[model samples]
Target: MGIFERYAPFVQDYIYRNRWENLRAIQVASANAIFNTDDNVLLSASTASGKTEAAFFPIITLFAENPPTSVGCLYIGPLKALINDQFMRLTDLCDQAGIPVWHWHGDVAQTHKSRLMKRPSGILQITPESLEALLLHKHAAIPKLFGDLRFVVIDEIHSLLRGDRGGQTLCLIERLGRLAGVNPRRIGLSATIGEPARTGELLSSGTGRRTIIPKIDAKGVKWRLSMEHFYMKEEDSESEAADIDALPVLEEKTDTAPANADPGLGYIFEHTAGKKCLVFSNSREECEAVTSTLRQYCELRNEPDRFLIHHGNLSSSYRETAEEVMKDDAQCMTTVTTSTLELGIDIGRLERAFQIDAPWTVSSFLQRMGRTGRRELPPEMWFVMREDEPDARALLPATIPWKLLQGIAIVQLYMEERWVEPPRLDRLPYSLLYHQTMATLASTGEMAPRNLAEKVLSLSYFHRVSQDDYKVLLKHLLKHEHLQKTEQGGLIIGLNGEKIINSYKFYGVFKENEEYTVRCETQELGTIVSPPPIGEKIAIAGHVWTVLDVDHKRHLVYCEQVKGKIPAYFGLCAGDLHTRIVQRMRGVLQEDRSYPYLMKNAVKRLETARIAARNGGMDVNPLVNLGGNMWCLTPWIGTYPFITLERILRLKCAESLGLRNLDTARPFYMQFNMDADEEGFFEILRAELAKDIEPLELIYPNELPLFHKYDEYLPPELVCKGFAHGVLDVEEVRNTVARWG
Candidate 1:
């Protein structure tokens, strides 16, 4: 009986008022797998590792020894600032066990959701777009608010294991367990899960149960890791210009210099001043240009701005006032965020996090180094990287510093294979099957069409969606009425699918953009994307405003604060990377190892990109040439098989290797002008990949490539068959062109 004596005595007096002398091998293997099995647990430790009190102290000691008649733990969090940081750590461990710790989203408060729909017992916390607006407007109070629900948990279950909001949180936990018949028992938490038995079968998918993942030994963390390198300047050398592999690459630009003197925002404003940091920035326009260059280096050292600025386009009172001044442990402040403060947001003693550049995953560099060591410390991060100074004649792949060799191949693929990125579970999501078949026909309205294809094709994330591609997506959503057909044959929600399910952004399934909001007098500064004239200025959460008034039918903008710098937009920042982190950044420029947290200009820019990848052979040719009928290639592969080998060289081996002017820098290197050579260009890409080709014949003529977010209300032949069969990988570009013949 020693899992802290099976928890409940107010979870062992809240783990002895947080002293926790023992129990934490993930809270004694999550209280011996939720008090010895009814299966489905999965804790997967690390990130201030008491994985939410190891799945809530044995599911709140089985809800204080069998007490549920209603709401007995549901939780779910993928940010409403991690459900307001686990609702103040589950309201100080369920207010000494009288329980009742609710929370709902869109910044809660509808009279605290009519006092949790009038007495819905302990633990609710939400947000899969507020549990798809509580199963679409509290559809008959989900069996009196979760009947006798016995534990759902979820929280950052590796950011809902790959997209369409993790298949709309597994179709809202299988339509809230068949509308509250209640199955519950699933747990799943994470620090940065790669494959805990495939995300514990995506957290017990239809909860039949069988997921236990508790191998917790966890204690060795220690990572105050570093990496540095900046440039935006110093040039002239690769024998100064004149077609040195035809120049043009130079990058690093925060308007190239002087925002309190650049050197990577003055080394992230000198190690984020008196600490309690976070910095981050991988776009909300570099989190408002690194919070307006670290608040102009606190107004050029007159001090006091101590920075702050979160992202996802700000405003929810400027991201809950930078999440209440970083959970104010006497606010030494830092913020400058994006990836919205990475995730499991506790934000208290966070003494360091920085990042600034290289984070396009190893699960976002272990969730921004799990926001900073938290209490038993050792989880810090640093990174920074930056670029620019190249183009003298810049060639060997532009004097490679590709974000400091992609941050040393994302820290040597998690220090030599403790890898992270998993759960893509083969796509063909067909835009989350047209958003769960128009949210199961707007929450089961006029059903029938074989009960709307057995409630949206028996949703186990649409089992790779096929009932003949959902009967050609229900005959093109009833020939574009977005689903109408009724007269009792049924399948309702029409008039353009009730203006796309009566917006509140139709309870999200990701991808948004069309924002505006912004404001200034009476503060709101948080959303921007094409809202520039009535005065024109705009930035966000980090200074510069000006605009004054441009209602455009209440999309709003009205701004005022104003000063200098500008660039900030709310859209487009895509990055994919993973072909095992671009083949471990081409084996960190063909190895010569030496990475004890780099520095000294990232170990002299990774020993000059390993002597320009050994004099441009790029570690033995992925083709190079670059003079006459040009060349380049360098596959190393990722971003959708480098967009399926640039549409198999512009739709089938470019006019038989005369391959004219191709051009690409995506998923790294392409440049063209072929006229065949290297073994007649891999024998014309193995005879046009041996004929019968079809990734929709490398899609072209009248391309409708609207990649996801309900692919522009689908039906452009199911958005070109969900971008030619669930976003092109063309068998990882035909197994890297079958090892180039």
Candidate 2:
């Protein structure tokens, strides 16, 4: 029988209702993998390629065939918005079949969750944090809720592949299985996974079952792409105010919003009017800035405000409103968002997507692009790169438009090689170890130290963690009162440990700053890490608000709308970039062939940058000498390696090369003042690297770097060990530098 013949009647009706002429390729593959095999499955396909239904149709059929006594499926999503979206979608498909769908998260109503607990059946959708909470608070009820769980579907699994949260999810599944005495089949779903085989391994890490990534014929997409570059002001010989494209980026335009506006914003504004779109920003600050700027443009142009804002800091009401607006086919609006919207939420009929700057990775680039082009349309994205005009006497490195070049390189990487970033599986993850250990103790009350070690260490995520390192952590925790030794020679949650585990934030392994809720007369704008004084204005929700009161006791900021502009203050967000991207960026400058996506202004900008790069001989030399004792080194390595190189220059090679006043532009270049010439600098770098040095040598004497969320709570020795052994990629740096010699 065909795949359609295998699906339950309800799914067939739903597919027929949606007017699907034939089963998608993914549907057939997923049915064969799930219906015919007992192994785990990984569904890696393009966005909106029927991946969700592909996995669900067969699973639902199996559920209908022999109903389990408890919830038959556990659906884990990375975001509340995603769960909510899927909850609605699944409800529509499953209601006719009498399958109850329950979504649990911070935003979910408790009454609905209580109903699920009272009679848990059908599918339960939850986030990892919520799942963590479930495992912690309702440890005994796990069997009652999911004793017969037959499947565990992780949506957007690529988002969790490289982080502590991914490890946490794996641990949660394993712990739940042990508690419930069942090994549910695992299935992963994503549109941007690079290495499916390795990802399959990650998916099936704890489960003894092998993971099946079925072979599907890859289909080519005709992407509608354009990239433009604009300076904050036109000071260069080429004016940015002119026509920016040889061919209009958008085939059709709505009414012009602003004639004399910031060219980049104007370009976005002109194209987005009367159309449904998403404007993605790299940061919440930029999202707010772009929203307010575009709203102000509308007011100046005497048009109705049609722009919306959505980010993690925004209240659920605000974010949900934006989501609803985008989901409605009739409503036309533009929502400026961060990575929060980049995941797989079905925002219907999105005409285009605009990126304010280059995204951090190739995976991100693909995800943002995937937001559109649904319903058989071409994937469409317009990249808008903006920077301040270079000063007349600016350093040669400063003259290059890095964002523009980086954006182009990101596009080329996917265009030429169809390459996406693979998961970095070599991390020590000591911080996660600390988190899972405390969680296990809290959930189980008390256990022998050996049993505790076994439970925690047996997790595949912690294989890289050594017993000595864990011992050091337990000793430190005991010293700090985060743990206590029971009279039975067991480990238990101590007073300090209880305080850490009691908070809602402890359920998550990701880092979070102290946030204060911002309110304006019954409406919640959002949360901010730090609030300005009682009178100073803060920016959020696409508008500025003056702080009326700061209730430190309650962690609330009462505010009133004001007319001004202020940058939103969030804590420092570390950069995550691959070395290959930086290397591709250098190659972008050297290439003579023009990218077809470059707009006229972007073309001119690239020409200017290439001229400047050639004159400095940067196309050939990784080392460039500025006037006087100033020099810059472009290592073309990834983030961790770049950080390692910085430490090596300051801590190891500084004395030999007389390096001082060091600074960096991330994976791009490191500029400093040094007494040694280019040849001498290379000699010193080569000599230091030639020694039998380890990643530990990159650290300064007595310096303890806290790089992870739980690093602060770890022992100093363990923290140093984790940073040196897990975080730094010294071998990659050495390999790249060897070619330079």
Candidate 3:
């Protein structure tokens, strides 16, 4: 039978109601893969291509013919927002077939979850962290809840592949399967993923099934892209050169945008007015700052506030308000957001997306750009790269306009190669190992050490962990009283460990800071780390708030709305860029090829940067001399390798080269004082790199907590080992230096 004919009656009715002239490529391919192959399936297609219905339609059809006694399908999402959105959509589709749909997340109501726990016979959608909680707290009820589970669908599967959270998800699935006594077929979904075959293997790991990735043709479509560079109107820049001149402005002139408004933000304000749009920032701090600045523009321009804020730090109410407002076709607004809104949320008819700075990865750029261009419009992205006007005496490193280069490189790499970053599947995830070990003991009550090792170590995600290293971890945990030994030579959670695993924060594998919830009277604004004292101002929710009182006991900050500007303190955001992107940045500077997406301001900025680089001889050599006994080296590599090289130069070759007072712009360039010249510097680096170097040599003695969340709890020896083996890329460092020859 044809794909549509194979669908159950309700699915057909829904399709007809939507007036789909035919099944999309993803839908047809998903049906064939699910029906013809016994293996797992990976569905990759463009956004708004009905990938959700594509996977659910075939699975729901089978459930109708022969519904399992327990929850038949498990859908795991990366975020609570996604589960909430998909729950409403999937509920409508499965309603007619008599299959109930349930969603479980922190924001979900307890009564809703209690209903599912009692009956437990339909589709249950949940986040990975919630699933982890279910596996632990409901250990006895697992068999009853999912004993007949047939399929496990991981949505936005690419988001989970690179970090400890992804490893935790894999371990949870395997642990759940063992408890429930059923090996469900896995289905992975994504709009932007790299190497489907390799990612497919990850999806099928521990499931005893290979993955079937259907090939689908992606049609060529035009994109609306423009990148502009700007310095704040109040600041002076060195761009007034003989060659650099602005072309005629293309964006609509904002006559009332305030004469002295920041140029980049003004451009965003001009375009986002009277439209449904998303302004994506790389960090929550940036998100808050952008939102607050844009709202001030509304006040200055005598216009209504047309912007909303969405991010992880925002309270559920605040974030949900943005989500709901964007869904209404009548509501014309823009959400200044972080990665929280970059994922697959079906905000209707988004007009355009504006990025304040370059995102860290191509995946993020694609995902943010993909949020728009739905509803028969092309995907549109406007990059507004802002930088402080460099001082005349500012070093060459500061004058090169790294953000502009990075942004151009991100676009060119994807446009030419059609490539995304491959998954870093190999990792010694000792932090996750520690977490899972504690969770297993707490859930199982008591287990022999050998059995515990077998259980935790056997997880496919822990393939890189060794038995000796596990033993070392156990010894450390015992010494620290995180794990207590029993009379029968078994292990259990110690009193100290109970303090950890007993809390909600323990469920997440990612690192987080202790934060206090901010409240204005009875309404909660969001969360902030290390709140300022009374009478101090903090920025959040697109406005400034002054701290009226601090409730340390309840971890709440009482505040009132106030006006002014201040950066929010949200801890640190780590960036790990790919090496190829850096290489492309170098290519952009050396080659004369122009990007059609570059706005006039960006074109002039690129020309000025190219002139500066050529005069400094940066086009030929990676090293440039700033002055006597001072030099800068552009590594042109990714984050990890850059870090590794920094350590190598400081620790290994510093004394020989008289390198001291080191400084870095990270992943772009490094500067330090050295006794040697350009040739001597290269010779010294080549000699140091040619030697037999151990990963441990690159690690600093004082930096143990730099690796992962649980590393500080581990023994220093094991922390060093994990940091060396997993975090450092010495081989890439060697290759980078070899290219210098």
Candidate 4:
């Protein structure tokens, strides 16, 4: 029978009601794989392409024919917002079939959870942290909750592949399978995953089943893409023969700029007016700033606020309000958001998306762009690249528009090579190992050290972690009282460890800061890190507020709405870009090829940068002479290798090359003063790499170098080992330098 014919009656009825032209190629392939094969399946397609239905239709059909006694399917999402969005989509599809679809997360109601606990059946959707909580708190109820689980579907799987959270998810799935005594088939979903075959192996890490990735024809997607550039100061526009004036001006670009107003934000405000859109920022701090600026625009125009803010720091009520308003077709508004809204949340007919700057990765760019084009319109994105004008005597690297080149490179890399960052599965993940060890002991109570070691180290995600290293960790933990030895040769949570495991915040594997809750009377406004003194102003939820009172003991700040602008502090947020993107960025500067998507300002900016790059011979040499003793080096590599080079220069080759006063711009370029010439600098680097150089040698003495959340708790030796082995790409750096000859 055809796949469509085999769908359950309710699925078929739903498809008919929605008036699908025919079963999409993805849906048909998903059905064939699920119905004919015993292996796990991966459904890869673009956003708004009915990928949800593709995977669920066949799984639901089987459930209807032979429903399991317990929950049949477990859908794991990276974000609570994604689960909440899918909850509505699945509810409508499963209602007619009398199948229950439940969501479990911190924000979910306790009554709904209690109902599922009493009679667990149908589908249960949850986040990884919630699942971790479930395994730790409800250890005895595992069998009753998911004993008959048949399928595990992970959405937006790409987002989970690069961090400790992803490793935690894999560990949870394996642990749950062992506890429930069931081996469920797995299904992975994503729109912007790079290497499907490799990622498929990760999705089925311990399932003992080969992954079946169906080959689907790439869909033709029309994008309404535009890019514009701006100088941070208005006076800079008139100084250097403005590139923006080289081409025909756009109505959006020609908008009058207020002397004190940010021109780029003004452009966004002007275009997003009277439309339902999403303004994406890379960080929570940037999200707050953008939202504040847009609201100020509304006030200046004598119009009511038309923007909302969403980020991880915001309270559930504040975030949910934005989600609800965006989902209402009648509500014409825009939300200034961070990666929290970049997931597959159904926000109902979004007209367009405005990205304040280029996202860190191609996957992020695709996800942000996918927010639009849900209702038969082409996916649209307006890229606004903003930077300060270079000084007249600025270094050569400073003259290049790095963001503009990076943005173009991201677009071209995807369009030309279909390149997206693959999974970084090589990390030792010692932090997660420490966390899992603690969690296993906490959940299982006291157990023999050997048995505890066997259980935690046996997890597939911990394969890279050695038994010797784990022993070292255990010894350190015992010495520090993070783990206590039992009276009968077993291990248990110690006093220090108990304090950590007992806290509600212990559930997450991501980094977090001690934040104070901002409140105005009874309504909670979100959170801010390190509140200022009383009477100072802070910005959040798109409005400025003055601190009326500070209760440090309770971690609460009582504030009232006020007018002004101030930067929000939410701790540090870092980005790890791929090396390919940086390499492509160099290519953008070296070549004269013009992109079709560049707006007037972007096109002019590219021309200017190319000219500057060629004039300084930066397109040919990696090192450029800034002046007498100072030089600039453009590594043109991603985060890991960039870090490796930085360390190598300082630790191994610095004294030989007489390197002094080294200043770095992260993954882009670095400037420093040296006694030797350009050739001498290269010679020192090459000779250093030729020797027996260990990555661990670059780590400074007594430096813990805490990168992950739980790294602070790990032994300094293990932290150094993890950073050297997992965090640095010394090999890539060596290879690049060798080729430099």
CA lDDT, every model vs. true structure: 0.78, 0.88, 0.88, 0.88
lDDT of 3 by residue, 248-328 (tens): 334444333556777777778777777899999988898998899889999987888999999999999999999999999
TM-score of each: 0.36, 0.97, 0.97, 0.97
Worst 10 residues of 3 by lDDT: 236-245
- TM-score of model number 2: 0.97
Give, for candidate 2, the lowest lDDT window spanning 10 residues.
Answer: 236-245
Looking at model 3, the pairs that clash are none
Residue-wise C-alpha lDDT for candidate 4, range 642-702, written one tens digit per residue: 9999999998888898889999988999999999997788888888888877889989767
Candidate numbers, best TM-score first, in rank order: 2, 3, 4, 1
Which regions of candidate 4 deviate over 4 angstroms?
Answer: 235-260
The lDDT of model 4 is: 0.88
Off by over 4 Å in 3: 233-251
